[model samples]
Target: MISRSVTARLMMPLAICMLMLCALAGVMIYAQLMVSSANRAALQGQENVTELGELRSVSRALQRDALNLINEPAGEARDTIAKKFDGRMEKFADGLKKLEGLDAHSFVPQDYFDSQHKVAQQLADVAVKANGGDQAGALEDFRGKVRPAEREASKVADERIEALGAEVEKLIASAESADRFAKILLLVATIVLAGAGLTAGFLITRRGVVIPLLGLQEAMGHLAAGRTSIAIPSIDREDEVGNMAQSMARFRDQLAAAEKAKEAQAELIVSSIGAGLGELASGNLEARVDAELTGVFAKLKADFNRAMEELQGTMQSVNRATTGINGGAAEIRQASSDLAERTERQAAGLEETAAALTQVTTGVKETAEGAQSASNAISVTQDQATEGRKVLTEAVTAMDDIQKSAQEIAQIINVIDGLSFQTNLLALNAGVEAARAGEAGKGFAVVASEVRALAQRSADAASDIKKLIQGSGELVNRGVNLVGQSGEAFTRIVDQVTEVSRLVKDITDQTNRQSTTLSQVNVAVREMDATTQQNAAMVEETNAAVSTLADEASRLEQMISQFKVGTRRDAPAPVAAPATVHTPAPRRSYRTQGALAVAAAPADDDWAEF
Candidate 1:
């Protein structure tokens, strides 16, 4: 299937090209409309020119027929000429009407048509006079008026026809020129659009498709070279390239898993060997390597089994020696147990003494702390009482200030009451004046009544406020007195707190001295306790060493028993003998050797597949 990038690259330019084509079509349509308009204008101009020429020809024919009618004898031939004159006049009139019916864009002016109409009328008049037997008078009228007017009208019509013909030619030329320009413009636009589409297609294909494919190729190369961690670009795209990259990503993941599994398999083998060796080092000769291994690990497993077999043989030999050592270790363990028991008893006595001393020291410290806490509490009480006194003093001062403010409020209320009384008097006077105005001041009188009522209410409220202010002032005075009493009470409390603080300070000093004496006694007991603890530690170490020896002997026997070392079932038990001390063998470092083994493996091969 075609990829999304390829589709977009093709469709985008195609769409743009379509739009350009549409625009070019629009330009052609416009050009067509312009040409159509020019053609219509040319046709109309030609028709007008043709009509004007006809009018001029008809005018000349009418003039000729009128002159001929006048020159002919007054007989049958004369009547025929007169009929011809009438026919010419009718034709001239019909032509003039047609010229006038032409559009206003016609070259002939309206005034020129008017002049032709006048000339036609004059010719008709001359024809009428000739038909009435006044031939000489008709001839004179035709020469002096009809013929001259007709010739002038003819000249103007001919000039207008020529001008209209020239205009038609110009319109045709312009239309052709515009049509050519439009075609050229469309051609150039097509070329430019084609070039742009090609260029864009190339660029999009390269960047969106070819470049991504190259990247995918490079990623695949890395994966082939065992670079499992390499990134495959364009995996997010919705195209063939993205599909390829995604496939590569999946391959990379599988490769990574395989790599990880190979490493894990190697690690599992090494860990199994290390675990068996570690158990052996910890005096467990029974430790064995067990794993479902393959490839190189299968060989490593065999080597591990051989090593274990050799180790088992060595342990069997050591087992015989441990049997003898076990007896001596038992005796030593019994002796150490007896010594540790006696030392523990002595340590117990010293521990009790030290605990008693620690208790005594803790009690003394508690008593001193209590005394100090009591002193601090008393000092805090004293300071709090002093602060209370200060707060009470401030409260009393605030009460006095409130009392003064209440008195000022009472004075203001009195002034408000006086103003209300004055306002009531003024309202009463206004009501009196409004009443004097009778019907004209009825509304004013009502307003004045309302004003008076409000003023009376205001006076009543002011009196109430004055009473409340006086009551508040009394209450404030009482509060000031109470605050003064509180201040006195706080002062007494401060004096009592000061006395209690002084007493606590004396007690605190005595307790501190007692605590110091107790601390010295506690130090001496702790030193004795430390010496006993050291002796007990020495006893415990001796006992632990003996127990360890016994455990080692038993563990050695147990370890050798775990292995299938002795082939003969009927062999007698080994005899007990004293164990001789032997220097330990030097430990071999396996870290470098294991690393070399890992490096020696065929890394390039897909071991995980196997």
Candidate 2:
């Protein structure tokens, strides 16, 4: 807000100039728009003239076509002329429709199109009559009617062209008049705004910047010369100059106060503080300021007396602290010795633990190896059982084939026994027929008897074979059952062995993990053992440092006891100072090695494996 008041004076005229420029631009734009509109209208007028001229040309073309069509005889020539006339008619009609769509101010009118249409119709009628063999009548109508109508349309086109030219001239004149008026307006506005801007700038600069700044400058000069009584001007204004005036006023007030305070402090310091400093230099800490003062000097006097008294009390506190430090140093020495002994024992214990872990890790590794071996053996057993199962399956199939073959053999044997019996009956009948004959009958009877015996032997052999096959079939059936049962047993064994292999694999993996875990534990324990040994060495150094501290503490107590300091009102009964010890500044890097925890256990689930 303060800055805006200062800058608005500079910017106000520029804002007015911007507004005036906008107005000038608006006038220029309006002029330009009027000119563009006039130009477009002029161009439209020219197009209308062109359209009128074109229509005249089309009318002439249609007249020629009609004349040609009427003179032609009824043949290909007449038909050709008729086609040309029709095409011209269509072109003329299209022209009339296009002119109808023109703007209201366009030169083309309905009366013009109606006249052209009447001329085209008369020409068409002339052609039709001539083609119908009434050439004379058609010629008369062409001269009297169509020709007159065409002449009238040509006159109308000429008038329309003249009217368009006049309208275009009027539009151009109006645009020129507007442009001239806008130019004059812009010139006058520029001059008026320029004069106003200069006047406003001068007035604002004089009132807002020059007058206030001059007054402030004079006041500031007085302030620099230490004439702080002068009043700063323009502080009530909301401007940068006013803010500077206020700042100057504050600075003057502070300077006057500082001068007064400095003079007072000088007199007060000599009267009161000088003696206290002299006593302090002589190590007389009990001396302090008691004189009363005011303003900043009052605070100074209180601070000086308080400082001297605090120094006296601090010396007495140092004396008591030295005594306490001596006793604490003695305790630290004893504790250091005890800590060294414990550190040595801790190192020994860590070494033993590490050794035990190593043994356990080795055992776990061995167990893992055994489990792996068992897994391999189980896998091999599983494969062998699977092979035995396959063999038993094949054996059962072979037993089945044997039983089927035995039954087939029994059927063949029974057929053989029936054939033999039939042959024996035939032989008996032959023998009876031969006995009824003479010598020939005797020879036939001997042959029949031999044949009968052979048949009986064959039947007995077939019967024996059939009984043997029946017994073999029963044995084969029993063997098939036994082989099938063996195959099922072998399959079960394969499954059990597969399961055992998986169990053994799991055991091997678990044992391996245990071995790895124990190895890590062993390494950690060994590291801790080494670190503990280092800590023991550090503890020996700590004991030596503690002894030195005790001696320094005793010496400090003797030194503080020489100072003359006030006693405390709330003092406790003093403990007797121990042997003297001097303490040193704390070591920059005192490090303690925290013991690492090592997990020690037999493999998890080890006993459960049993």
Candidate 3:
């Protein structure tokens, strides 16, 4: 198409050249016509001018013969005059004959030629009649013949001269007309030659050279500007411009390809870096990359992920340990509460027993003061035990809450671990693809490696956290056991203390109310002591159970803290060309080069010597 445009552009010069050639030919033809016309006019004018001159000379000869006869004796002059008239008349007739064939319109003296010839014939007739007369009579008769005829002949001669003069004027007019036509033809020829020269010059300058070169210049400009998509103008001809346009188009394609390559290279760099960063942030370790740029980013990402995983793992371990410690603390709190509860029950029983003793003392008088003092000491001990039990129960409740939180944390960590594994798999796929991509995939491979490593690291960290949580759970169980044991021991102590109180009470009753009242009081006191011990034991068991629950919560909380489960990497789908399209590589050709070179030349044809 570009070639065609170039050819069309060149056609202007050819068209102009043809027009100029036509003009030149027209001028030449016109000049030739004028010359022919002028020559014809000149030839006809010359012939008429010659005939008129001959007629005038013949008329003069006849006039001279008539004059000679009048000058000599008529008889002697008659014969001579007759002979002269005869010769002159013959000459005049020949002149008339010459005039007769010439165009009358061309020669203005035509009427004069006719009149002179008639007068000359009349003069000749009279002269011939006078030659045979008597001498005197012939002389007289010759006078009569010559005089009148001579006068008429002279009139004709005068008219002939006047006509000849007019003929000269007509010839002059014809010559001038011919000269004007010749000049016009010459002018036209000059103009045609000039037009042809200019047209030829213009054509040579424009079509053969200028437009094609301009096109090439434009193509070069586009190339310089990095416009690889430029399209050359179409030209019809298989000429230089056409070829050049093709070449420029090819060059544009090459440049476009190079541009695409550069773009792809840049994209690869960007994708690789992006993938690497994504992997690192996602938390993978042990990932390695060998990207186009030495895989520095990928390696860095991998290392970072590894460090994060290790840190998370360590945190998880610490969390687990803390959970176990929390559980143990809760169990300890429960056991202490149980022990306190049991002690309180025991103190209560002791106080009751002291009270009974005091009553007995009261009945016995001397022992009454000692018994009262014992009762007071027992009451103080009971109050202290009750306060301690309340503190233990509160501590156990706190431990249970902490354990619940730890369990939730553990669940979250598990989720994070799963996500990390998925990320690793994705990275692995990316790496494989990059590897398969060859040179172009180098960057992607590196990113994939980083992602895989991060995933592994995250998994490891989660595993460690899980272990920690398990350990903490065990510790929580142990604490629970300790609490249970403490609760049981506390229960036994409370029972023993209650029995002492009952016995003391029974003694008081006996001292106060004789044998029957004392035995009944002892039995009622023992039953009350047993009931108090059972109540204390139940409180201790409740405290222990609460402590165990708190420990479990703490472990869960520790596990949950390990992961940010919802953390996600969002990325847009990559763009790709249709699979069916196959882009061919650049090819080499000379046509393009030659066309370009030719098109680059200046179109003015300054080197044309002509």
Candidate 4:
């Protein structure tokens, strides 16, 4: 059960807590929404009451204004009062419309408000009619009909306003109660859920972990204190605790066996190698254990004798090994010192190389950026040149159109000039005929003379207009040629700018490539420099290790010399050496190192021409 309940212990409590919190939140939100709705309704009711009060005031004002309009004589004073009455009428209608537009009016009956506004409209009519003529009749209707109707309507509005006020108060009270109830519910729910959650969490923790852990803790404490004789609880259960308890039991059993085995081994070792131990203590490495014992003791006896023999050989071997180690240590120490110095020199050189490359990279990157900027500027110049060419072309077209229009105007002026010349010729012919008719034709002759003078003036005016058109035509032709020449110049400029832009772009590309290669080389050099520095450090460490090894070898040899061995000239076979350990060289990842030298340059803004 405990094993299967692992997931439950972690998940169930959290699920319960979340469920409780979500449910509480839902309830609180719903309650808040309800409270908000009620509050809004109450506010709407208040607004309606305010609108009704304004309407009632406007109604009373309308009555006074209407009365004034009826009583004031036919004069400016009455006209001014009439305007006031109209304004009051408008205000009264607007107030009624505002109340009718309210959300409260949507569900409430509108008949009460309808009857009220009807009274206001009737009173307006009575005042209007009285202002026009029928003063006595207007007064009769104003008092008997309009006044009574307004009173009744006003009474109804007052009742409605009072009722709305009461309803609003009820809503306000209800909202306050709901708000308080929602707050209480939220608080109580939170407390209850919190308590329940805490209780559930405690039960899960106690059942799953605390109780079992307590038992395990006590058992472990006993085991740590070397109390392995007692039984461990939960060992038979199939759970994590059971597994732990079982492991401890196994450890206790093994510990007891080790103690017994140690005792038996101690007895056998003492009985078998006691003599050899005594000889060994006496510094005699020739002692031998000849007891043919059984089990591990048999091997122990052979081992004792062999150890003595090996000790004899080892002592003799140490004498020669110490001299060799001393010589080797001197040679190694000299070699490592030289290596360290060389490594330091090499590292310094690599560092200098890296620094130089970095500077070169920075310079090249700047050059590339400068080239790119120049290229961009040239491209912009080219674009402007192209746009200027477009404008010039449009100007040329406009100049050509103007020249055509001037030519058309010149043709029209020539037609007018011809017409005026024909008119002058006809007027002269008429005067000749009039002169032939004698005294009666004298008036006609004068009229013909006037006509001839008018014809001449018309011809002169047409001639002037023709001359101006010809001049304008010439100017338009000149303008067209100038615009065409400018267009050609702009085209040439655009071509030159485009070529310059292309050349600058080429330079930028080359500079960028160079900068990229330099940066990659810089990165590679840094990697190599780092690797060289690591090698230098390793060499220093090796020098220290060699020194330590030499000291340890000397101490071991001196210690071996204290033992008394037989005259064993031949040394036993030396032990095979363990594999040497080496630290790997530092490396860096440069994915583009090989390609950097052969590939096209990068177009990055950071790249320089250098």
Residue range 264-382, candidate 1, lDDT tens digits = 67467547655764564444545667877776566555654554444344344345544544564565455445545554654575577557666766787798799889889888888
- For 336-418, candidate 3 gives per-residue lDDT tens digits of 46444544645485456646644553455434344545555655555555555555555555556656767887898899999
Return the top candidate by lDDT: 2
Candidate 3 RMSD to the correct structure: 85.9
TM-score on alpha carbons, each prediction? 0.39, 0.40, 0.33, 0.40
* lDDT tens readout by residue for model 2, 1-610: 6335554554565467568767766666666666557656665665666567667778777776766666556788778878888888899888766666665234556676777788878887887788788888988998899878777777777777667656755765565565456445644564455455445644664576556755755664565455779988887876556555665565556546655777856655556655665555455656767776677666556655655554455455445544544554565566456556665766787787788777778888999999999998888888888889888988988888888888888888888999999999999999999988978799999999999999999999998898888888888888998898888778757755775686588669757855775676577567668766876786676576656656655665555454456654555435555654433322122121111112111222111110
Which stretch of 10 consecutive residues in model 3 shows the poorest summed lDDT?
A: 592-601
Steric collisions counted per model: 1, 11, 43, 9
User: Candidate 3: lDDT of 387?
Assistant: 52
TM-score of 4: 0.40
Q: State how far residue 335 of model 3 sits from its true place (Å).
A: 99
The lDDT of model 3 is 0.49
Candidates' C-alpha lDDT:
0.63, 0.66, 0.49, 0.65
Where does candidate 1 stray beyond 4 Å?
1-6, 74-84, 105-107, 214-247, 262-610
